[model samples]
Target: MKILFALISTVLAGGVRYIFEVANGLKDKGHDVKIVALAGDHSWFKNLRAEVIYKPLNLNTFSSIVYAFYKFYRYVTLRSAKRNPYDTFLLISSKLGVRPDIIIELAELIRSFDSDVTVATYYLTAFSVWFSQNKNPFYLMQDFPELVEGNEGKLGLNMFYHSLKLPFSFITVSSYAKQLIVENNPTAKVTIAHPGVDLNIFRPRKANSQNQKYYGNIKGV
Candidate 1:
């Protein structure tokens, strides 16, 4: 099957890593898999097997020009920041009258693929997937994004909550997440798909005497 995973950004995060692992596994199983994101930065993880398409926000309008200037200001002020700036920039641009343009562009990009199944990895991308031409849309609900701490006053929290109620089949990693999705949207069709660990990388190993000795000295040990 031809599958496409839509993501907000390709940053270094556990959820992003899980998406890459799942996409790679699907590719290894002989399925055509691709990932589409707003920003690209995959240097942290190595040996990515699936293809990635990056379509950053680009609007040729007066508001977009102002947004670009704001981005430049943020870039200069938050140069020492570690998080991806595009994530917040996208949210802020929405209030600047560039959101519709972004949505149209993203939907057009998604339609160009014509994949059999299109999956939204994040709440922001879910909007694009819903509006795209793809008939089969699935949301990979890894967690309760709206309930996450530190996002209380941000626009993303409200958007995340609203995205859950959209008409789409949901796939989650845990039964707890499934319960949350059902509670939030009673009509949601959710399926649990637990993450798997690779035995080659996580198998048992013989204990080292020196390491044991060092750890044994601690009170907890």
Candidate 2:
């Protein structure tokens, strides 16, 4: 089967690592897997088996300039109020579907690729997948973003919470995550696909000189 995973950015994060590992594993299993992202730092990950496509948002467009000014105004206001300005505009824009330029750019990128299934790796990407001309959209929910600590305010939390209600099959890492999704949106169809460890990289091994130098005095070596 042909599969595509959509990511907001390929930054150095555990969730992003899991997505890459899953894509690589799927490719090894004879499936055509591709990863699409708005931006990426490819140097962080090496020896990737699947294709990664980066389609960054056009910030030079007239609409984007207007959006940037609006964001700047909001940033100033939030900073004056001593609140986190980051993610505020993006969360609201995504919830209200007001940023046509960003949505359209992302949608066009997804439509450019043909895939039997397209998976959203984050809530923002979920919105993009919903608007895209893609088939079999699935949301891989790593956790409940709304419940995450350090969110600016209730408004931000609400936006994250409401995003979960979008119509898409959900795949999560743990049963607890699935429970959270079902409890919040009872209509949501969720499946638990636990993350796999690469035995080749992570397995029982004896302590070498380097390990002994770091933990030679520890109780368990």
Candidate 3:
């Protein structure tokens, strides 16, 4: 199955690395994995088997302007074209070739790729899923979309931004993210997909006398 991991995350951030790990793991299973980066930053995905889709303008701002214009043009054509907006920061950083925007753009490029599962994260990616011709849209809510501002009033407006139009079910990485989402949207159907740390890399240290002696000799000599 073709899996498109729409990434709208910064390089070196945990999110980007997670995408790479998942993509690679999928590829190892002989599945096709493609990365949709709203902003460009090819270096991070260098070793991954996934293909990165890059867009020129930022997904956040460019998408907003596009959404605005799309809203304006909707009545003209008598067609309903609801625009999907992403974060402002992702848009601006896209110019600098940010990885997050690249992921957002990848989701929009849905029409060109045949995908069974479209794991969408960020608002822009969710919009891409909405654009899909026949793909299962899955929203990955990593954090409280509204609590981002730390103000209830702004939270309401931000929620008004796009929460009502949120796609299929949501899979969050943390209780905090899921908690905030559930609070704002009690009826919102969201599932928690707890984030994990690689045991070999993040496990507690175990010191042995022999290893310690080697380290001590290496440090001294």
Candidate 4:
């Protein structure tokens, strides 16, 4: 079966790793797999079985105008008002970097490919996929994705939480994550698909006598 995984980035994160692994595993089983990234470090695409498609999104004309005005407002506020720099950046960067229309364009692109199965790896991507009218696209939700601050941050988080109730089925990384989605929408279809670790990379090693003695002493203390 041909499969497509839609994601915003292939950065070095747990969710990104999981998507890569799943794509690789499926490819090994003789299924065609591809990854779609909006914008990310080009180096992150190296050594992947899935074909990486880099699709950079530009703001539409109206959005660009709005963004310019928003930036100007922010600049003026920063100069006149005393605000926490981190919070300010978080508030502005959350939705400004990628607007809803950009995600919609991305979804349209993915749908054009006509894969047998399209998977949305992020809530935003899921929105894109759903809006594209894909029938039963799998949503691989890895986290709650509350990586913002301030009133705008809570709004972003709420948007993500509500997206779980959409028609798309979900595959969560852990039971806890599945429970969270269920709590948001009891009728939501979610499954737990735990990630696997390579034992060779994380295998236990025998401790040296000195190391063992140090641990023993520490335990006693």
Candidate 1 C-alpha lDDT tens digits along 1-221: 99999987788888999999999889999999998877658878799999999775664587567666766776799864343435656656555633444455667788889799999887767888999959899999885764542433356677777888989999999998888788889999999988888798999899999888888888465
Per residue, candidate 3 scores C-alpha lDDT tens digits across 42-148 of 57555777777755544466556755775678757877643223333444334443334333355457666778888776655566666664467777765454544
TM-score per candidate, chains pooled: 0.76, 0.71, 0.60, 0.77
Top candidate by TM-score: 4
lDDT of 2: 0.75
lDDT of 4 at 56: 49
Best by lDDT: 1
Residue-by-residue lDDT tens digits, candidate 2, 1-221: 99999886677888899998889889999999998876656568898899888774555476466656766776687754322222333455556645435455667788888899999887667778888959999999995654442443455456566668888899999988888788778999998989988899999898699777668668454
Candidates by TM-score, descending order = 4, 1, 2, 3
Task: Tell me the spans in candidate 2 whose CA falls farther than 4 Å from its real position.
Answer: 61-103, 146-153, 204-221
Candidate 1 yields a Cα-based lDDT of 0.79
Give the Cα error of residue 110 in candidate 3, in Å.
Answer: 2.2
Where model 4 places Cα greater than 4 Å from the true spot, the runs are 59-92, 95-100, 145-152
| CA lDDT scores, all candidates in order | 0.79, 0.75, 0.62, 0.74
lDDT tens digits by residue: candidate 4, 43-77:
56446788888664455687567656666776797
**Candidate 2 pairs with clashing backbones:** none
TM-score winner between candidates 1 and 3: 1
